[model samples]
Each structure stands twice: as structure tokens, then as C-alpha cells.
Target: MARSLLAGHRLQHELESAVDIVSRASRMAREIQKRYCDATQTVGDATTLAKADASPVTIADLAVQALILGELHMLFPEDRFVAEETSSSVQDERMEGAIRTWLTQYSTRGVDERVRDSIDLGSDAGGCRGRIWVLDPVDGTKGFLRNQQFCIALALLVDGLAELGVLGCPNLSAAQEAERIASGYTEGIEGEKCLTIVNGTDGCVFFAARGAGAYMQSLTDRREQALPQQIHVNANTDPSWAVMAESVESGHSSHSLTGKMIRILGIRQRLGVDSQCKYGLLSRGEACVFLRFPRPGYVENIWDHAAGTVVLTEAGGRVTDALGGELDFSHGRKLPNVRGIVATNGHMHPAVLAAVKHVLAEDVTSG
Candidate 1:
């Protein structure tokens, strides 16, 4: 009996270990976030570089990416990584200075070939296969630079599906703060510029596996004592009653198309947020639906929504391509097959699908 009990306990421990990986990722995100928040304490200030593509690269993005990659390498050695940054960004004299300075403050692990490769791998432009990790490092660079709502996004993909997702939204609050969360200020606090934790208090972290149900936690707290609340989509099919989340950055999605969809659905209020926090909101039942319809020819990356998909699914929500098919991440790095994605509380998913199809059909007829 004693041996059997020990074996059972060990089995439970392994099961919990998989769950603990989410916390480990979250912990790293928070640590990097703290460093980033500290380095950029001044508002309207930043260290910038011009990538070859001319897109802006800030110290905050570099520092945080380095921090996360360093931790990932240590934690999962055999795991492959598909990332967003390339070493070339750090090689440019202009970018090199910024990279060295920013990383100096945030990276306790000195830069090495592995770190360089991690950045380079992100810029590698290779397709995904087998088991791989996809990282946005920082999803909303503009938001991060502007000190608006941004997030560090990480996802683990296995056989083309996101098995795990971890999003660190530093600026969100758990407390009900009016219509929009104030910029620079987190939730729970009345008003303060200092760094505040929303995880245990008002801000939440969402996680889920394929079939294991979704769970939410306060960013600052990670105790198993409290059971995670399961969530489901609203059964209300009335489009007028729907509350939805939209992208704050128009470039990340198609605002015009989103507006049209919203109008068609007759949703009265449309909320905007940065990063995967939209998934967090949906999981908690704060919002009923979320949509990401990017421009034509631009495919959405798996890293951006993989983890969130599992979390929402586990929470009784449904996620799929805009055409109502399941998201397929296995083919390659970019989700090439799907043009858009729709996420909703399970109850409203079919209705949402019908509404989307109706609108598209009408557009075809009108054209």
C-alpha cells in the first residue's frame, strides 16, 4: 500500500509539473516585465533602432526577449524555438549599441551563441515542424514603447496545435475599471504610476491544454490552494447584446472589416485591448466574442493565439478559423491555411459563425 501510494503521488506530481510550466513562464515574464518597467521608468522615452525593414526595435523588446529566451533555454533544452527577432538587429552599429545597453540591465545571463541564435532563429523565416515553441517576445511593440497596454506572448505547439499558451499583460487590472483600463496605470489601484501586480488581485493569466479545461490566475499569485473557475460562452444569441474585444492597433487586424462585422452583428459596444489579454477577458466571461481579421495575403502566426486557444477551449469557449474550420498550426510557422480567426464563448459560437457567414454571403451577393 505504501509503495502504491508513493507511485500515485509521483504520477500526480508529473501531471502538476506540466501545469507548473505555465507558472514558470509567467514568473519569467513578470521578472522581465519588472526589469523593463524599471529601465523605461520615464514616459515618452525610449531607446530605438531602425531594422533593415525599417521597423522600430526598442530596448524594452530586446531586453524582454533576451530574458525570456534565456529562461526558456535553461528550462527546455531539447525544445525547438521559432522566434521573432534576428541577430542582425543587434549587429547594426546603431542597433548594437541599443541592444547591448538594454540587455546589460535586464539579462543576468550574459549574451552568448545561444542567445544570439535565439534572436537569429526568430528572424530565420523557416517553417514549423515537429514539436516547436513560437514566441512573439513582445506582441505590442508600439504599446510597449508608448507605455500603453502590451503583452509578452509565448506558445508551445505540438503536431500543429498549441498545447500551451502564456501571455504576460503587465498593464491590465482585475478590478472593474470603467470602460477602458487607463494607460500606464494597472487595475486594482485607484491611480499610481508604480508597478502593480494584477495576477493575484485584478490582472489575470490564462492557460489551457488540448482537453484539460482552461484556468485563470492572478499574475502575482500562484498557489494551488484556490481552484480555477471554468468559463463558458454566453448562451445569449442576440447580437445587439454582445460585448466584444477589438485590436487597439489597426495594423494587427483589419479595423474596417471588424467594424463591418460588428455592425452586421449589431453589437452595441466594441472594446479594444492589446495582446492576448482579449482571450483572458473572454475566458472570464467579461466579453462574449473576439475576432482577428488581418489584411489579405497576411497570415496570422500560430504563436499569437495558440496558447489562448487552448485556454479558451478548456474554459468552455470555442475557437476556429473565420470560415468555421479548426485552426491548423502543423503545416508551418505561419498559419497559412486560415485567413482569419473567430473566438467566442461556446454557447454563442454557432450563432457567431452564422452571423459571419451571413455577412460574407451578403458581401459576395452585393459584389
Candidate 2:
């Protein structure tokens, strides 16, 4: 009985620590966003090089990874991490120096060598054995370059099951702020529908722990009355009335296939977005369905979806593979056992899964 009580206490402490660490990391990421968005810095300045798979890595990505890993190391020295970015991508001496400079700006104790090591610490191969922290420092680099939707996603897994998740959406408007502003405008104005504010500078931070539900709060510097408010998935069950959120890049997920599935499911509106912010939107009841059917031979990284999966599930939503299999994260960095992903508000998951299966099978036979 004593051991049980101690374990519970440890879990609570870890969850709280994770929330604080991710929030600080999010703030650092927003500073990078402001620099790029305001024309003070260019995309070329932030982008260093592409990975072997041709995905771009920017200064923000490497810097955020270093910041988060550095903090986690100080907080939980024994914990392991799996992240997307690596220091090797920053081959240019100037770029590497720039990253170190930003590290000092964001964190208090930034040792040059130690910070570089922290960025490389993400290469650890994670398994289902012990506590593993997963991170995608900058989930959608392209979207971020365009000053569009993106996120900094983080999650903690115990024995391969997600225990905690946090996401920072720098371009997302606070739901409460949105509603408050919307309330002031009269309904019958000429551009009333277009007047809705969808994005803001302060942005939002979403966090969730297993069985504790999900909550969102403002990601701002002001010491305002920022209390976490519970959020959930939309209650819409009818397919015809549902909206689908998908990736903006076709290569990430087959847009043609998604369109076909959307047609089959009779979903009327489709929102093309970037990064895990789609999951954030779904968790906050903005969208009813989120779909991603990667090309036939593509494998997904656990960091890309781990945080979003936990956040959505805790917000009364459901997540699964294209064939409705639970995502298996025990196989190191990549989700080798899972193929494509499908997320919804749990109301239309069955119908959506059936439609996905039917569409994919038809495509297979036709090809």
C-alpha cells in the first residue's frame, strides 16, 4: 500500500513537471516564430539543411529540441528521449553558432558543448521498457516558414502507452478569446461570418494526462488570469454535417485518397492544415474528423503523433490506424506496426473507418 501511494505521487509530480517544461519550450518556439514572421529573419536563415529523407530542419527545430532536452535532463536526469531533429543537420559553423546563441537567449544555463549534446540526445532508440519522452520540436517546418499552422508536440510514454501530452500552437487563437470577440459583433453585419478571428499572436497551449481529460490555456507572457479550461470533441454524429481536417501537403498524406474517403463518408467541409494543430482543433471541437492515409510504403514516426493522440483521446476523441488498430509505439523511433492514422470525435469513427477501408481496398484492386 505504501508503494502504491508513492508511485501515484511520483506520477503526479512527473506530469506537472512535463507541463511546465513544454510550456517554456513553447514560448521559445513562439519567439522564433515572431522573428521569422516580422521579416526580421528569413526562412533561409532559420533553415539549415534537409535530413536524409529530405525533410527540412530549421534553427527553431534544433534550438527547441536542445531547450526541451536540456530542461528534461535537469528535471529527470535518468529519463530518455526520442526526437525528430539532430545536430548533424546543422553542418554550417555559422548555423551551429547561431543555434547556440539562441539557446543562451531562451535558457539560463546554456553550455555550448552540453547544448549540442542535448540536441543529439534525441537519437536514442525508444522501446516499451521504461519512461520515454517523445518530441517533435517543430512539427510542420513548411507551414512555419509560411507563418501558417504548426505546433511543438511533446509526450511521455510509460511502457509504450502515452501518459502525458502537451502541444504548443503558435498560430492558434484562444477559443475563449475568439468567443469573447465574436460576442461583441452583431449577427446581421455584412461580413459577420468573415469577422471571426481564427489566429492570434499569444496562441494557445494544450496539455493532457491520462484519465484527467484535456485542457487549454493562453500561451502568453502576461500574468493574466490564465486558467485551464476543459475542452472536448464536437458532438456532431452525422457524416454529412461533419468537417474533415487533413494535411496541406499531398505528399504527407494522399490528398486524392482523402478526397475519395471524404466523398464516401459524405463529409461536407474539409480543412487543410499543417502539423498536430489539426489534433488541437479536433480536441477543441473545431473539427469532427482528422484523417491521414500516407502513401503505401511510408512509415510514421512516433513523435509525430504521440502527443496529439493522447490529447485527442483525453478530449473524448478516438485515434487509430487506417484499419482501426491501436498505434504501437514499442518498436523504437518509428511506428513500424501501424500504417496510416485516423482520428475523430468518437461519434463517427466506425463509419469513417469503414469508409477508409473500403476506399483503400478499391484503390488497391484498381491499381
Candidate 3:
């Protein structure tokens, strides 16, 4: 009897542990977004010079990452973190002093060192066998610099599968704002003076855990809504009529080749965006398909897709690697050891898979 009681308690504890990690990740993202809001006030504007990688690194990313790492440590100290950016980039003789001095103005004392090291973890390439946290402190660096869309993408991988993901999109407006922005109907905006879409004037956050459903929420307390209305992709199966989202930056993906395939399938409307916003859009039923087909042998880091994949899947979408293998985040820091990614509302997934298989077949025959 005592053994049975202990087993039940242990199972319950594990289940709660999963939920807590995912929930805290969402909270951490929200905290980071809030910190970004505060940092931008002091940084003047996000128009900083580019890094050697030609990517932008504003005070926003620095502050937010530090805040997130601190939160992760507080919430789950034992988990490993694999993130983007590193102290080395910030510490460059050309940039370190300026970066450090600038960060001091807005950040707490501890934040300086925390940001430096966490980013280094992002640059390092090891640790995937155990539980880990995959983080893209700021996924769309260019977008963030341009004052456009970007996301704080986070996911939790146990063993090798991603069991939870949380995405913070600070610029997204709520449903009410979305409607007003689309219709040009903003007589008395309720929330803060942020972007307004047809939905609402608040920022958007996406969260999902395996087995649990995906949900979206307004980052601000504008209308005090619960979250995004549960979303999924469109059901149209005719390939030609499909609409898809491709990386706005061609360098991040093989846009020309993806376009060729889109053209081949006769897909007409293609939307270009950054980060996991495509996944969020897909979940909301705004877009039906998203394709990230980079070079033939390119591998994607887990942070780029972990949260977005789980969110889309929980929302009733399907995501797979380019070769149609499952994207098992359980494997570690990188994804299921494959190239590229594809996500769609499940209705058109089979067709997409068939098309991809056909393309690979053609490539092989040509080879």
C-alpha cells in the first residue's frame, strides 16, 4: 500500500514538474519582454551598428537574455542552457567597453556578467544528452534592430524530446488591436500605445506543452483576456491555392529554391516574416504553411523551432524535418539530426510530404 501511494505521488510530481517548467518559461519570456520595454527607453533606438556576423545586437537582447537566464536559474537551476550570442562577441576589444558601459545604465549589477556568460553558452556546441534549455534570446536580430517583429524563443528538452516551449512576441497586438489595425478603427485604443492588429493592442505570447493544448495571450493587460483563441491551419488541399510563410531574410533559408518548389506546386500567396511569428500566425489560422528549406546539409538549432514546433503541433498543425522525419527534440540541443523544417496544418501535410518526396526523388535522379 505504501509503495502504491509513493508511485502515485511520484507520477503526480513529474507531471507537475513538466507543467511548472513550461509555465515558468512563459513567465520568464514575459519578464524579458518587459525588460526589453524598459531597456529601449534608455538605448535611444535600436539602430546600432551590425556585429561581424552582420547581425544586430541591441541593449534589448542583452538585457532580456540576462533576465531570462536569471529566471531560468531560479526556476530550474539544474537544467543546462544552450543559447545564442556569447560574451566573446560582446567582449571584443572593439565593442566590450562600450557594451558594458551601456548595459550598466539600465541593468542591475549582476546582469552584466550573466548576459556575457549565457550568450557564450549559445555559441558553445556540446551538451545534449540530458535535460536542457534551448534559447534564442532574440531569434530575429535583424528584425529586432529594425523595430519589426522578433521573438524570445525558449524550449525545454528532456532526454531528447522537447516537452514544452514558450515564445514571447512583444510587438504583437491582441485580437481587438489586430481588428482595429486592419480596419483602421482606433477611436479609443484601450491598451498601451503599441501595435494594433485585428486582434488587440497588447503584445502576444505563445505557450505549449506536450499533451496539453497550445494557447496565446496578450502580453499586456489591455483587455485582460485569457489568451489567443485556439488556432490551426486552413484545410485547403489544392497545392496551387496554398499560402506559405518563408523567411524574410533569404540568407536564413534557400528562398529561391523554396520559391521554385512553391512555383512548381503553383502556390500563389507567400508571406515573408521573421522568427516563430510564422508559427504563431499558422496557429491563428492566418497562414496555412511555413517552409524553412536551407542548404542541402544545413542543420537547425533547437531554439529556432522548439517552442514554435510544439505550439503549432498542439494547435493541430504538423511539423517535420525536410526529409519528412519527425522533429524529435528529445535528442538534445540540435533538432532530430536533419536539415530544414516544414510545418503545416495537418490537412495539407500529406500532400506537402508527397511533394517533398517527389522533389528529393528528382534531385536523386538528376544526381
Candidate 4:
């Protein structure tokens, strides 16, 4: 029924169009990804590269945002876009120069005036009315800098809800297994392994519309012309056997608290990764749960989780705030009304969320 609804929705055509757009943007970003990671000379050696050279991530971020917004705007002139990068915040002339050369060399459609000019498309204050596009051009700068895991997240929202989502993971591969996640990645790049992860050269794309279910496909390789494979959350009813996916950076989520929650829930396995690709991981059954508890006073930007929500939910998973509140995407750019985030396969959500609530409540009471 959901698959049929994916085609029936008024926005289905737009969703279909986005698969190609996101795939192209993802490949373009991969070009910049190589340069960004190569700056470190050796992978995972953050000390080797100076902060001054770190602007390539920004270059990729801004350029990709522009490319997506530019092409989408031309196609849907009346649609508004709310993206992550803006001209006011772009103070790096060197980065601007970098994008000019980068886009000229790597962009599939070639560099155009409107691409850079569309940088401020983020200025629009989106709300729950009509159709709007939300995008995080480059979701994990750290992951990109390290050449590990990163994604280009884009979504189409109608009346404040994400109906279509496209997650372009330039590092994730379509060949995934939950066993590696359960035991721990011991074998690929930089010591910690991702047997199914792609290098900077090629990647995968995960996409879905609300009622259409989720799908994963290969990216950057034209000869394959591979058909997308439908995906689903794993049926891991026991929390003890569950594998959780979380942020690679402890700063983004409180790992100490996460440790407590997983321990309480009997989940022994965890795979720390960057960006919204965690959503893809869950949707494709590589991982069973995802949890994040931001520091107090922190609110998530819409672009951070918008695309991820649809991908996971459509794959028979569930998403809600820490207290199990439905995620609210109507209040412009930030999820001001929501706190934290929890995602799991439908069978695991109830147990995992119960544990999350108990641990958090205990922490609050102790504080």
C-alpha cells in the first residue's frame, strides 16, 4: 500500500526527479571530498592539515548547496529552498575562489552564474504551507575531512512534513550486513573497518518517499545502471542483539549518557559514524537503532535530520524525540520544539525508547 501511495502523491514527480539531482550532486561533492581528505596527506591524521586549508569542506558545502538549489529552482520557480549555507556567513574569499575552480572542473553541467548566486537561498524562512525544499549539502565536515562517512541530505516538505527524502552517501556502499556492525568494524581505512564502505571515488545513494518505502542504489558508476533495491529495517525484537549507530564525534552526542542508556537496554554493539548516513544504515538493516542526546540548549536545524527521517520511517523504522515526541518540522529552520532524537526498527523502538526515557530521567533527577 505504501509503495502505491508513493506514486499517487502529488509530489511523486518531484521525488523522482530528485534521485538524479542528488546522485549528480553526490558525485560532484566526491570530487571535492578527495581534495579535502588529501589535505591531511594521510587519512585520519588531523594534525597534518592546517585549519586554513579546511575551507575545502566549506567550498564543497557551499558549491553543492548552490548546485542543488540552482537546478531545483530553475525547475520549480515558485518553490522555496531552505539550505545550510548562506552568503552572509561565507567570509572566506579563498574558499570562494576554490569553488569557482572546483565547479569549473568537476560540475557535470559546468559552472554557471546562478549556481554561486543561489547561495543565499537559505535566507527563506520556511514553514508549514505549500512546498519547500530543505538541504544539507555536506552533512559531516569532519567525516569528509577524514574521508570516512558523509552525505548530501536533501528533502521535500509539503505543509511542514517531509514527504520525499534523498540521502546521497558518498562513502556508504549498497552491500551491507548487520554482522559487521554487531561485532565491530575491524578491517578498511584508518584501522577501524567499513567492509562495505566506499572510498572517495564511488558511493551509494538512499532515497524514499513517505509512502513509497525506502531504496538503496549505487552511485557514480554509469555502466551498472543498477536498479534500486528496496530496503527495510531489521526485525530485531531483542535489544540485547541490537546494534546502534551514533555520531562519530562525542561532542555532538553525549557518549557517556549514551553508554548508560545502551547498557541499560542490553545493547552491546555500537558503530559510531558521521552524518545522516546513520539513517541509511538503519533503513537498510545494517544497524538496529540510532540515538543522540544533544547538550542542553541545543536545537537541531531542519536540514540536519529532515532527509533522514523519511528514509528511516519509510523503511519500517520509527523516529521521535527523546521523550517519544513526534519530530516537528514546521517551525522554520530549527527543531525548537523537539529535544534529542531516537530511531529504531519498529520492533525495537518501544524497548529502546523506554530505556532512553528511563536513563534520561535518571540523569535529570541526579543533576
What are the root-mean-square deviations of the candidates from the true structure over C-alphas?
7.0, 5.9, 8.3, 4.9
- How do the residues 283-303 of candidate 3 rate in per-residue lDDT, one tens digit apiece? 777667888877766667778
Summed over model 4, clashes come to: 0
Alpha-carbon lDDT, every model: 0.59, 0.78, 0.60, 0.76
lDDT of 1 at 84: 69
- 1-367 per-residue lDDT for model 4 (tens digits): 1233366776767876687778878888887667556645344232122334343345677778877887787778899999877764445565566656656655455456644577887677989998899999889877787777889999999899898899999877666662243223322223222222334345788888888788888885765644678899999877666777888776788777777777777776678888999999999887898999888888899999999999999999999998888887889999986767999987888888888889888988999
lDDT of 2 by residue, 92-168 (tens): 77777877787777675454456678898898899998989999999988777666668999999998889888888
Whole-model lDDT for model 4 versus the true structure?
0.76
Which regions in candidate 3 have their CA more than 4 angstroms from the true location?
1-52, 91-115, 118-128, 176-201, 226-228, 238-241, 330-332, 360-367
**Candidates sorted on TM-score, descending:** 2, 4, 1, 3
Question: Which tens-of-lDDT digit does each residue in 38-153 have in candidate 1?
Answer: 44544323455667867566655555566566555655666677776766556455555554555555445455434455465454343445556777766766555545556666
| Span of ten consecutive residues with least summed lDDT in model 2 | 186-195
Top-down lDDT ranking: 2, 4, 3, 1
Maximum-TM-score candidate = 2
Candidate 2: the clashing residue pairs are none
Error of 4 at 120 (Å): 0.6
Please identify which of the two predictions, 1 or 3, would achieve the higher lDDT against the true structure.
3
Runs in model 4 with CA error above 4 Å?
Answer: 1-9, 39-57, 89-94, 105-111, 178-201
Regions of candidate 2 where Cα sits further than 4 Å from its true position: 1-10, 37-42, 108-113, 176-198
Error in Å for residue 162 of model 4 = 0.9
